[model samples]
Target: MECLLGLLKVKVVRGVNLAICDPLTHSSDPYVVLRLGQQKVKSSIKYHTINPEWNEELTLSITNMMHPVKIELFDHDTFTKDDSMGDAEFCILDFVEIAKRDLSDVPDGTVMKTIHPEKANCFATESHITWKDGKISQDIVLKLRNTETGELVLHLHWVNIPGVAR
Candidate 1:
């Protein structure tokens, strides 16, 4: 299946107004962990801050659209263990319809419709689709479950693999 893999590029832009998980210090050393099946990638830790800007990019070979990508926020700690702040999940199927649209066929400033997850612990309110960098890309803003306090921004690009069916 590796030969049929499509590249999914995910850019974890930044987080805003994240929950302060550390009660003692009233701040959190936040970092993001992205998981797609057995593959996992982590961002650099931002010490003692509720808001962290990690403009990190990760590329994953996706063989199945059924597998949802998990995004979890954690507070890095030196002592015991990392604390779970919040989490969100999104599937590549969410963007399948929009991604199938050819970028060259669409006019500039054309905004594709946003997609929402059917069931998710954390999910983006909306995604803005635009033609950028010679391809179609999306900017997604995800909000934490059970509260409107935490927000995480992500940029995603779908790179088509030759001989793979969309």
Candidate 2:
């Protein structure tokens, strides 16, 4: 099901759970779309059950925008049959702002690092990064299953860098 989130001129921060709790019966896996002016960015995660201590942290980042922004969340139903959004509660745990930097800004000695354990890859998926016209784009996606609840958590991150200091 498609859910429209109207922030109503509210400030958006990373790690904010944009889940719509009222309309959903079961906690649906969430996919988010962020719009900065005409540029749209998207991320998503499949629903996962929380234990006594909720350890779900979906982190996102947006930088260097001087325009209005829009964020929307869609229920990810690709992995399950029961689409009722029940037993689901979501929240934003933390928000941290990062200085906007561009691919051109990365120095010659700069190094990019990612963690992809062999076991993790055997179980989960991997991502790819692209660079073009001095801009960098990455698509990060993960579909994971919680051993305890047998529920799936889908995570996706996408970012585009348009302007890097030359």
Candidate 3:
């Protein structure tokens, strides 16, 4: 099953209105970290700003569609421990569904197709899917929780590999 799927590219576009962990001070240096399975990627630290823009892209060799990608925000510290700002997560099941449907045109096997989310739901507002450059991509905006207020914007591209079983 590991060799059946292709790579998934995740682009961490930017963060908006991140919570300031250090309220006593003026501003906090914010940074983002993304985790998927054992793979981890960190964004550059934006110094003394509430709204940090980290236009970074990370790629992951996806084998399982059930795994959810974790996005964690933190305040960088020089001496002491880093403060945890907030976090958000999103799954790639929708992308996998699209990929399977797009690859169904191949000669040999039949792949399953799924419907896109068009109604108001928990995972509907910030998630969207589209086809571009012979690939299926999704853009997601996740609202950070366990803190005051924060949001993370992400763009994911799923490349389809030929001759792979769905």
Candidate 4:
């Protein structure tokens, strides 16, 4: 038996973050497939209600690929054995390396606090961070020019944990 999966385009900016939505209405489980070059990432979001929504944000960490990463969303029941509904496309953003700050590897005197807002009986907080060289200092705005389009895309904010805690 063969299975057909949806297709989506993923764009990543070296330091910028992007959000992708997976909308599937007629299934009990709606999940998405993220393809980064030869690497494929599957979602863990399952058991969704009708018209389930998944607004997932991913940060650009790897800068070794030249092709656009692909992201495909599908209904779990229809994702296998020729039951796929469809796919969504997003251009994987490009990223630039500026800086890296690991919590356990930080130097000293760097304060980091977490702020989580309660919504729908759930706690939400920013958990992802991609350090860059630009920072707003002395009430001055800082920006980085995109080499491709001469556009300045800030890696706005980080809001997602990196991996499972040991």
Worst 10-residue lDDT window, candidate 2:
89-98
lDDT ranking from best candidate downward? 1, 3, 2, 4
Ranking by TM-score: 1, 3, 4, 2
Q: List the candidate 4 regions with Cα displacement exceeding 4 Å.
A: 1-28, 48-50, 55-61, 78-82, 93-166
Cα TM-score of candidate 3: 0.79
* Best candidate according to lDDT: 1
List runs of model 2 lying over 4 Å from the truth. 1-25, 49-65, 78-166
| lDDT by residue (tens digit), candidate 2, 78-132 | 5554232222211111100112233475654332333242442311334333333
Say which prediction, candidate 2 or candidate 4, comes out ahead on TM-score: 4
What TM-score would candidate 4 get against the native?
Answer: 0.35
lDDT of candidates 1 onward, in order: 0.77, 0.32, 0.73, 0.31
For model 4, how does the per-residue alpha-carbon lDDT over 62-137 read when each residue is reduced to its tens digit? 3333445444444455444422333322222222111222345543433233223333211122322233233210
- Winner of 1 and 2 under lDDT: 1
Clashes of each: 0, 8, 0, 25
* Native-referenced Cα lDDT, model 2: 0.32
Which one wins by lDDT: 1 or 4?
A: 1
Lowest lDDT sum, 10 consecutive residues, model 1, at: 115-124
